[model samples]
Target: MPEIVGESLAKRLIAWGVDTVFGLPGDGINGLMEGFRRHADQLNFVLVHHEEAAAFMAVGYAKATGKLGVCAATSGPGAIHLLNGLYDAKLDHVPVLAITGMQETSLLGSRYQQEVHLDRLYEDVAEYNLMITNPQQMPGVVDLAIRNALIKRTVSHLTFPNDIQIAAVDEDPYAHPAPGTKPVSLPNLDRPQLAPGEPELRAAAEVLNAAAKPVILVGAGALHARDEVIAVAEKLGAPVVKTLPGKAVVPDDHPVTTGGLGLLGTKPSEEAMEECDTLLMVGTSFPYGKYLPDPGTARVVQIDADPTLIGLRLPVEAPITADAKKGLQGLLPLLRGGDSGFLDKYHKEMESWRADMKALQDESRDPIAPQYVVGVLDELAADDAIMTCDSGTIATWSARHWTIRDRRQYFLSGNLATMAPGLPYAIGMQHAFPGRQVIAYVGDGGFAMLMADFLTAVRHDLPVKVIINNNNSYGQILWEQIVLGYPEYAVRHRQPEADFSTWARGCGAYGVKVTKPGEVRGAISDALAHPGPALVDIDVNPNEPPMPGKVKYEQAKHFTEAFLKGQPHKAATLATVVRDKINELRS
Candidate 1:
């Protein structure tokens, strides 16, 4: 039995279900990479081009799979580059175990080639940052990193010094993880409560029972509370309209689910939110209050685990601080209704909206319709396919188009909207669910930011499919310019288009380039069917704009004011625009 340091640490990470660690290797972290390579049989090391993408992929993997994700980098610049992605994970509550190799311990105070105080550098992004001083502490620190990451639901870090790379402890203490390292309990926590204050529960139950038109507003916290949401909705005969973060808590196409509400929302979801009289904000703090109409005299009953979040945004009529699952359990038994018309009406509206949206997709034959590509993708994916989406218009399309029918999982930046998250995210998701199908939807500009990571995915043999919507420009900026009435400038990629397909092929990844609308789906399907990593670069239609909830009457006004100084005012309300849309759906 050999004593160990980074090598043993890598070995132990594998036992904890960390199959792949995404990051670039450099001088400072060469020892860690070397250690990882030595244990290649036990752990798979992903050599990415950028530490940033490495971090993001870990974030994605953790999100899609519910396992603590691992990513590594060298000290100095490598460590610095991880900040953006790490923060994204930190803010979104993903569990990531970040490891970095630093300069020799002897160079602690010196400006040696990549010597920096990494512990301090990563302080803000990690829930727990461990600086390994000796091999003896390796096992504890590694285990601590994993446990803390899962418990706190945040990024955790371990920094290794070059001098301690091969130090021999009394023994290879971290040979294996203890049994029950990962629990199989309910993902949503259940605990003892203050009996939910009988009066409060009764009042909440009565509010739900008596209401005819009820809307369930779901969010990410709601995902953990899925059973609770469904139970309440079923008992009360209500429709569910989730926020983007809460999209898959209930099947998107569930008869009771109107769909997700946000900028890229469907007519049913928006109308349901606007028209419902009693709103149940369950386990979600939907940050966008503007989307919440002054509630049209609607009453709100919000259930949240975090007490601070209750009534933190908009005041609620009934705010319960108990766990959503428990609270809903108590409330559901008290209400019984068979008003099937609510779901029936939403189903009808959903069908009409789908038809109109499909018609819009069919109209986009100019170059490649990303919308239609997404729809075809929705068809190709298995019922349980996991999708990681990049921020931008791609998020818009995925939200509106990718039906969570039957089964599926979707990960988006939600509110962060980081530019280059999808490719790395696909890697993470694939890493987590090795046998499950994982795909990343990205835009040309976003993919360009971290396209080099395809090599890392290849090296790990992660069978993740990356679909790039190559429209030759930042589509979001173009939309911004359009809404603002400004001339398009500098938003397009100025660099010569790197042959991404060739780049992938060169890295041992299958690559498909689809320029025409007709070829997009076939290329994507083939790449997905491949046994290993692949990239599909499809030239998408640029004129297919990203519309955000009909554009805020104020933001649109500001865009016009800033860009078109003397333009006529766009009408505040357009009755003709959504008139028949509402009728066709809800009439």
Candidate 2:
């Protein structure tokens, strides 16, 4: 048999260490699917129900492993279905390679069936997008796409014309060697170390060392630099505040951590931002500028790999452009230890904040509070479990109360903030780390959107545990409307209330429902013990509010008025929330 381009592509992917791929099969990519089949022992293709899930699984896999993730789709609709997940990877700065099939070359400009301008469609989401029309370019193009994705920390796209996929490979595209050297045999695809110059590092250190009270804000990009970030925080006696996506960069229970620093953050973080004279931002471009201190009030020192993002969100007093690890390493030597009083003050506030949260978690209501459920689940979950969360109120709760520690990985649709990624991310995480525990905290709104994929887990025998916050409503939108001084409308998911656990059982997985606080731990424990996929539907209190870190009087007033005008029946719940806010302020 002659060597085919598709087979060469498969072999190249395996050579580059691609063990698994996620996608659906279609006529446009049948030739490529055959190649995958030929290399079954070397490559595993996970068949997902939808192309969107395939892309999300790719994003999830990249996030969990910090390596390149690959996904494939057919022409037109299949390629279009990948946009949302591709955006998630793009915005979050993960490495992902997307392989899309195009109509045959002969059919180009002839309006072929399912024909799509895939190269143009993928332009915005991919840092490196290319179309391969020649069969000889197969293995080389594949290698280049993977290298670009890994090196750029961004998405790369390849559009292969259907007919060319199976065409005969005549010569090696990579035969050309360097000047006066032999033909290159093996490719070296690796990222180079990026660091700041000595002067820039010294300038950043001077700004930090001169400040009387400094605060550290870390983001997802700083995950690999956790130890360095912690050391800098300790040296400066600064309290660490995480952007939502960076929640796990430092253990929440760490002494220097004041928790997250936005709407979903803790009071200590909010207070620290208000009082700090200097801010050291590491590897984050958190979009909410209003949540951060006024640029005039706090001098900013930013450290990031991307120069364009160094001072994008706020004005920077000192900018150090380097990878997080190297950037912090450069600053550590010039840093001077400050008075311990600042961190000590915030530590006391953090303790008080935790106590207040505990009171809410222990509050006995007819319907169990979601906080209580998450609190107990936090205690019962495996120390090293990977937790993927959906957007909206579920993200808020998990960010604020998840108690991430012990090298547990946390993932969500960070910059895109898209819905329905929790389950797909969980699926991918479980696929990457088969022996590690994987859990997804999903809201009913998100869960309903992609619940069909639960069967994927069952079919693959992936033992992922899903915890659904069954509030029967778009909880986040409801609160958003109220806080914006508008009555809640069209946010409820009423009637035909779903029993997610029962639905899971029907899909050949373990199922359980927890309506009482007492059962939260048991339900979670049972799900973990089950040797297969499981769903625990937690019917939490619908009236519980995801309060902001720093609540304004105007917001409280608006929330009260909205509740009275539209949901008069829940006036009692509104009053309770108001009273709690007042008490929090008093403390």
Candidate 3:
């Protein structure tokens, strides 16, 4: 029997070094499932509870390993379910390939069962989108889709009609090739070695060397250039501030580092940005313009692989278009040793900032503080662990409290800032590094969105530890409402809160619930030691506010107005805020 399109596509994926595919099975893609079955030894299909989870798993895998991530879904609604995760990949600039199934070719334009136009639906999200109606499209289409995803660092999609999926190829497309013609082959995965020209490097160095106070801002693009970043920071006497996704680029305890910058940033970081005369942005296009130095007040030098992002966020005096690693390497030698006066100032501020943060993690609080929970996890988690975080107040705690040390890697929905990727990301990270420790730090609302995937962990024997900040509310939105001068309306969770620990046990995994501050550490320890998948549901104080780095006058006034206008739990919120302020003063 000749090779079928589905089999050919499967073989092509394996040839391109895809060891696993995440998806849900359905009748719409029966032929593709058969192909996956035949290649079971080489390619493992991770069955997800939802197509959205499968797409998120692919994104998590791609972000963790820097390899092309692949996911599949059936036609119509299954394909529609992939939009959220695909948009996450697109916004974060990760490589992902989405494979979808379509109705039979005979049903073309008939609006048959599950006959949704996937090509049109995926247009905005995909860098390359195609529908395979012919068996001969085979290896060529698959190869192109993978290449587009990897090369562009974005999403690629392909939809296969049911009838065409099983059609046999009559002839070898590679056989009897014309002279000087090369047959379709696996794409080259190595990134092109790109560096800024000597003139550009020298110009950027001049801006840095001339400034009396220089600050270095790093992002996810700078992950691979840790040493180079440190060298430049040291030479310029600059404090290194990271974007959320760039948290792991420099260890939290590094001498030149000053944590993250933004709403979820540190006081020292915000100060450095405010006082700096020159801002050096590397590998990141940090979207929040408010957190950056005022335009024209500070000279900007930016280095990134994408030329379009060079001056996209802030005004640039010198823009170097090159990979973060190469750009930093070239500029390092050109930089001259400068005064340590600027860095010394922030070092002292960082010391006080650290003390204030430590004070906020008081384990004596009756209702467990979310800060305390994260601090304990930071202390107990393995040095080389992989952490995946969900959006909400959990992001603020993770950003400020969880210190990235040693070989630890952190991944989150940075640009998209979407919820529900936490558990799926951990699952993907566990699959990528089978023996390494993987943890998902999520909020009650975010976890509850896709809690069904906890079974995916047990079924696959993936040892992923999940820590839930069980506040029983949409805590972030609640605070946002107060800041916007509106009373909290629909942010609270209904009565009879979910018992996630019980849910974990039902899924055949280790489960622990901690209600008091004292039980926090032991529960976390037990969950981490459980050997298999585990979940820790810690009932934290819902009224505790995730304070910003520096509170603005307008925010304070609006918060007060909201409280007067009938914010729920206003007394509890005020007490917690007062207690934290007192601790800060004492520290």
Candidate 4:
């Protein structure tokens, strides 16, 4: 039995459906790069200025195509640089293979240059981490990483020690071939239901039967039984209100669907959730618990895929452990249809909320409405286009305002909330889904954080159109300073004139700049028309506010600082926002 080493790893990479790899080839890992060069016919290598962007690009690709993404880096600093994006992948559950080179196997513990314990460092952030110590373990390790990335739906890692790459080995590709894809369904477990379950279920139905205001809170879990979820909502004459992760669970324009609810959510969703006494949270978990009004005072029922979640965060008067689809189906027959009063009350509130939301477009005066820009993008994007949004206020914008429906896809780093990640991910997505349009919306601040990678798109001719929201500052942080009673520190940046279009032309691609609201549609048209990579840079209004949230200003400022200052997993900031998301649709 023979085995492969460095070049063989590259071959196995292609066998596992990896079409591209992003990373820099440094002194410690030139052998893998050489292997990649020989197999250039089957694989493409994207070069970026930093390893962080490479990891982010991989994340975007997975989000868009529903396939495993691959990113690599040299030893030491290069591998360390990937931690930021690695954490991002872990939190979002994006499948990624983060490969890195290591020092000579003999030198690993000798404090040699570029030598570090790669496996231990990556353990917490990766679903599985491995150090390829032998050529015999080559293909098996490679296959395992890919399977973990896809099956666990998480970040997986592999490290190649310098000595092993140059060591003598065999060349059997079948030592381990790629595995099959995993099922999308979450696991069903056996757990006990609360005592008041059946009674509470009927009581919740009574509220649904009796109330004039009823809104259904749809979470990401709805993806499993979309048809059943829609059927249940329509049968009860309830409007669907979603959480951030559940943006696309229900159609945005569905007469029975309200948009996302959060800091960047719309008044319609807020009014429906906050004012409605009878709230049904089904198939998802809303982390912002504090935002949810006390269930004890209101009629609250929870239907979760996992039984543990039934009463995990807040005590659900009604907790159903069955699949949301199964539970909803079971409960519907027992529900007696109610009068028009509750539905009419919710409808009235939704109408007023819709009017207030509509007024945002009326800010058609200069600087351009960021809200409308997002709206127009939603309208112009192809039916199947995959959109990736950066973290921060722009993330809120997409979650709250983007016209995502049951069929559309909108990817966000909702759990990790990293900036400057959307562009790189867009490039990877374009490679994975060559036929589908891939669009990325990034704030000026976030874009600059990884600006150089725009060239990576040009080099590969990955025709991704980027919408740069040029607000000239850290817009969200600035608002926090004002509201939180802190002087604006590090929030403002010099209004730099970044001629992305000119740069695109220089880079052998396309670029368009729009300064007003009217120009957005035409620019988007021009971008979609262009043959290759292009960017639509729009000067957005910094004052365009988010939908709504309960985070205090001062706390928000410190939270942003913790992220920008390199403190990953700082609980104090994220803890506040992680409250059980109360999808108490006012409707």
The predictions' CA RMSDs to the true structure, in order, are 5.4, 2.9, 2.2, 8.0
Tell me the spans in candidate 1 whose CA falls farther than 4 Å from its real position: 11-17, 30-39, 134-138, 170-203, 210-212, 224-228, 293-298, 320-327, 338-345, 494-499, 555-587
Total colliding residue pairs, candidate 1: 2
Tell me the spans in candidate 2 whose CA falls farther than 4 Å from its real position: 171-191, 575-587
- Between prediction 1 and prediction 3, the one with superior lDDT is 3
Candidate 1 structure, TM-score to reference:
0.84
lDDT of 4 by residue, 1-587 (tens): 22337778887888777788878778767767877887899888888888999988888777666667788899889999998888887776568899888988777788898677889889898888988776667666777777777765689999888877756455333465433433323232111222225665676566666655556787755555566666766666666777776777766666666676766666566666766766778866677765565656456677875565566556666666555666777678776664545555655666665555444543344657676787777777887777888877788667655776535777777677778888887887787877888888888878888878888889878898889888777877765554444445676566575656676677777887888788988898889777788898888766554526345565566646645665422343233223212212221
**lDDT (Cα, tens digit) per residue for candidate 2, span 116-215:** 8999988899988988877766566676777778877899999878887777766444564322212223333333358789999988888999989899
Q: What is the descending TM-score order?
A: 3, 2, 1, 4
Q: Where is model 3 poorest over a 10-residue stretch in terms of lDDT?
A: 177-186
Which 10-residue window of candidate 4 scores lowest in summed lDDT?
Answer: 578-587
Q: What global local distance difference test value does model 1 have?
A: 0.75
Clash pairs of candidate 2?
none
Residues 56-108, model 1: lDDT tens digits: 98888777766777888888888889888988888777788888877787778
The local distance difference test score of each candidate is 0.75, 0.86, 0.90, 0.71
Question: Looking at candidate 1, what is the lDDT of residue 105?
Answer: 76
Q: Cα miss at 194, model 3 (Å)?
A: 1.8
